[model samples]
Target: MARIQLNNIQKRWGAIWGVRDVNLDIADEEFVVFLGPSGCGKTTTMRMIAGLEEPSEGEIVMDSEVMNEIDARDRDVAMVFQGYALYPNMTIYENIRFPLRMRGVPKEQHDTLIKRAAGLVELTDYLDRKPSALSGGQRQRAALARAIVRQPHVFLMDEPLSNLDAKLRQHMRVQIKHIQRELKITTVYVTHDQIEAMTLADRIVIMDKGAIQQIGTPDEIYNDPANTFVANFIGAPPMNLIAGVMEQGTFTAPGVRVDGLPAKHDGKVTLGVRPEDCTVTADGGHLSGSVYGVEPTGDMTYLTIKVGDKLIEVKAHRDYRADLNSDASVGFDPKRIYIFDTASGQRLR
Candidate 1:
């Protein structure tokens, strides 16, 4: 049972800081994801936890023991990277058995452990094939089987599925989820993909500029964002934000007037509304504009409307279609609107 805790974590190089003031607690068997764009310090935090990189300031505790001075080999953590990292000369069976051999497990048990691990990942038939003979997906499964063979207390996976194509990625995502649930080990996964984070994590820790932006369940993160950054980051076509003025709970801008907001302040603000929350209207809605672009994404169509100088996307029915530059209108419930301070980017609760 590994319950990991990080306190006041910080990492720096000379004067440039890579991570800053990160504090998180991972319950035993909890699957947490560190999600962000590139250069956001997600990978750095994971490395520090793995004992690959030491934090300049902080304490890492695993199962009530301090790990700052401990060697990575003693951490009882398994890591699966984006690359296969398999030995070309070794068969998949030998590759999966490498960890057990290095850990000094009895030679009599190697066959049983290797077979169980390979079977879990559906790589049982490919055990005799070398890494070079396997496809990319098969190679990744070999890496996963290697990690699983260790039966470690924690698993650290960094972008493990990013190397696969879309279809393979989707398949691997399902397999990973099933494996994690079956093993029930404390797992920390790092990825820049929101879909992966949303689908896999029990909770998500979103980071930006070397700092944590927010930590919550996927439902909370998607429906209730903390600020403008989170509002724009989590969705496929993120929330639409229009710069305007908010006075007496009414937001007004050129070609947009969304009234009955919840804010009491009066100043420059940004109005945010999700595309799915909007509906196409024959009557001139609170917001109307010309169709700037139309894109059909199989199940639904996305309409880009030019509201004055700002472009906002609205989710329409799959059958909806209109000529470019045609007049269109969109309406949303007042309760669904999100208000943020334009200058500070903070939500106006």
Candidate 2:
């Protein structure tokens, strides 16, 4: 419904910067997610776009119109909060129709609007039910339906799925993705959940401490992180960060030696290896450590190794689950290794 452009967007809370120098272009009908850890300014950035919070600097334009002077209600955006925010006394029908009614849409149009929204979210079954009678997933759907009925130019969601249990959250995510795709409305979602960001977003904006760290597709973020923070933040079990000194093209850590692969640093540098990228070797690997434990996650197994004082974790397929408690040799793929400046935490090619 709208293409969003933010240029040098800044939000300052007194001396503290909530977000700074953020420039992003979100295509019309694209699903974009602002993702990072808590206090990373994701929500603040979303609020600025929604006009709920004013930016200290920069420009926000929606569908070619500058929005600096526009109020939140006039911005034609609908926001879904994490709390659901459903009216306890209102039935599902009333809740869904509340937005349209507030705008005094014709009485004849309310039923058609409500039905279409309920159908999109598959909440027609519970239209007569109160918020008290609905399940967590159902309640979330009701809230989503309410947002849809308004037909806003852009949709803003701030961790809307965080409160649900694991199973329901997964189901709801699929449903939300489907609904968003079908409607083709511009959407901005904010969450710290990497899985949610990967699955739902067409492009993900990774933020940290009020600055935009990286913005890319899921594969781009996962396979090629911009810096150490992004490498550590986006993974499920997370990437292993080991401190090592590069000497004569060999990397040596306190307890492990990574041979063959060379580095350009005589000074200490941090090496990052994704769990899945670490391979188990029979004869000799780059590093050897005592097996701390094994975590079986249905299809894949995670092996935690104790190398001197440091713990390294690696992911192996189900076949390696039997190697638990045994001594292990690990090797990182050369192409998969990420090197970061020890002092700056910036990526070093």
Candidate 3:
């Protein structure tokens, strides 16, 4: 069992802070993902946990033991990087066996361990092939097999699926999640892709500018964001944000007015609504705008509307049709609307 805890963990380089005051408790066999844009410190925090980078402050404890001073090799953690990192000169079997060999495992155990690892990744048939002979997905599986061969206490994967094509990435996401479940290893994955984090993680840690924005299950993060940064960053087209003023529970802005909100503040505010939660109507809608663009993606249609200077995206049925530059009415449920403080970008309860 591997229960990991990061206590006020921080990483610094001279005056620059890479990660700051991160505290997390990862249960045994739980899959946690660190998600954010580039330079948000997700990778930095992962490196600190892996012992690749020393933390400037705080402690990393595994199963009640402090690991800050422990060497990476002795930490019993396996890492799969964005790059496949396979040995071009070596066959897949040899590559998978390298970790076991380095740890001086018995020669008699190598064959069984290697076969099991390769089979787990469905690469048993490709064991005899060299890395140069394999496709990107196959190569990544080989890397995964190598990590699996070690049977470490924890798995640290840093954007393992980023190098693959879209379909392959989707396929590998399932495979990785399945493998992690089968192995029941405590896994901490780092990625910038919100889709990956949403689909695979038991819980997600959203970070930005060396600080954690929020930590919660996928449903919570998507349905209830902590701030404007999270609301804007997690979605595909992102949440539509309109600058406005709230007075006596009524929010008013250019071409928009939403009522019945909690009258917490009456000054400048930002209104957030997701594309899927919005609907297009004929008349008497909450907001009115001119259709700027329409994109049909087989399953759904995304309609972009210009409300004054701001553009709002609404998701509609694939069969829905709209004319560009035509006036459109957009409406949403007041209960679903998110209000934020414009000055702080923080959620307004």
RMSD of each: 1.1, 1.8, 1.0
Give the lDDT of residue 64 in candidate 1: 96
Q: How many backbone clashes does candidate 3 have?
A: 0
List the global CA lDDT of all models. 0.92, 0.89, 0.94
lDDT of 1 by residue, 206-265 (tens): 999999998999998888888888889999899998999988878899988887776586
RMSD of candidate 1 to true structure, Å: 1.1
lDDT of 2 at 240: 92
Instruction: Report the backbone clash tally of model 2.
Output: 0
Error of 1 at 275 (Å): 1.0
Q: Tell me how far candidate 2 lies from the true structure as C-alpha RMSD in angstroms.
A: 1.8
TM-score of each: 0.97, 0.95, 0.98
Off by over 4 Å in 3: none
Q: Model 2, range 135-250, lDDT digits (tens) per residue?
A: 88899989999998978889999999999999999999998899888888999999999999999999999999989999999999999888889999988789898988877767
- TM-score of model number 3: 0.98
Candidate 1 vs candidate 2: the lDDT winner is 1
